[model samples]
Target: MKENVFYGKGMGPIKRDFPDIYEAIVELNDAVYTGKVIDYKTQKFIALAIAASNSDDRAVKKQIQSAINEFNATKDEIMDVLRIVLLTSGMPPFVKAVKILYEVME
Candidate 1:
């Protein structure tokens, strides 16, 4: 993963105003994303699928970007995840996430 590539809203304010809490959160994230057994790339794909299922456009885009930039994730891998989203979450979020994926790729 990259050094300073956290993808979340309001992190700047949280890091500045509440440094301890921010550090704790970062530490937790690090622990969770340690790539033990599952690997970080697959974890990112899971996160992407979850974001797509939730219809969170920004998070989906961010996940796609991070996967590509950090893990060199291919279109096929992302499409595979989106296929799961289509089955589990239905069309709306699946289509929305697919659109975001294309936009990010472009």
Candidate 2:
């Protein structure tokens, strides 16, 4: 399987210490990201919005980076996603996500 951007700093230890669980998670991720109907880029944007709505700064940054690196997503595209976040999740998460987005862009 390709490297998963969702695997953060602890993944190496998890992969070494719990191979079965690691593989299960990777397989699940692959299955979910199949792009059968919704394209991967759109899926990623949805994921980004979810992360932002949850006020997860690290996840927001990671999603933004992954979208840009994997799909060449632009600031405008990210801003559009944040606009949805702002509407649905309110200002705190939206502001936090925007801050993380700018940091990632920089």
Candidate 3:
């Protein structure tokens, strides 16, 4: 089966019901993801860290998978991202992101 790109179960209806909001969200995602001062790979890692810090499992998983699949991020590289989480957010979010990392890496 294809990996579910839609992170949340409820997002589909929101996209359908509020096309304008969904379009705006997509535009924002594209804007932030574009290459600027930061390279794309590093940008992805930053996004991963942000997602991990937020302790959103689906976001963490998606970011992790994106890093791995797009940038071929290694285990060590992932650990490097999570270290920031450990430092700023504490162990709970770090551990949760780690768990999500493992789930996606599997």
The digit string of per-residue lDDT tens for model 2 on 12-78 reads: 8889999998999889999998888988889999999999999988888888988898888999999
Ranking by lDDT: 1, 2, 3
Best by TM-score: 1
Candidate 3 residue lDDT tens string, 1-106: 1122456677798799998977887777777767778788888788789888999888898888878887789988999999999999999999999988888778
Q: List the residue pairs that clash in candidate 3.
A: none
Best by lDDT: 1
Backbone atom clashes (below 3 Å) for every candidate: 0, 0, 0
Cα lDDT tens digits, model 1, 47-82, are 999999999999999999988999888888999999
Of candidates 3 and 1, the better by TM-score: 1
Model 2: lowest-lDDT 10 consecutive positions = 1-10
TM-score of 1: 0.94
TM match of model 2 to true structure: 0.92
Quote each prediction's TM-score.
0.94, 0.92, 0.81
Give residue 91's lDDT in candidate 2 (0 to 100): 98
Instruction: Report how far off residue 54 is in candidate 1 (Å).
Output: 0.3
* Candidate 3: count of backbone clashes, pairs at least 3 residues apart or interchain: 0
Error of 2 at 87 (Å): 0.6
Per-residue lDDT value at 38 in model 2: 89
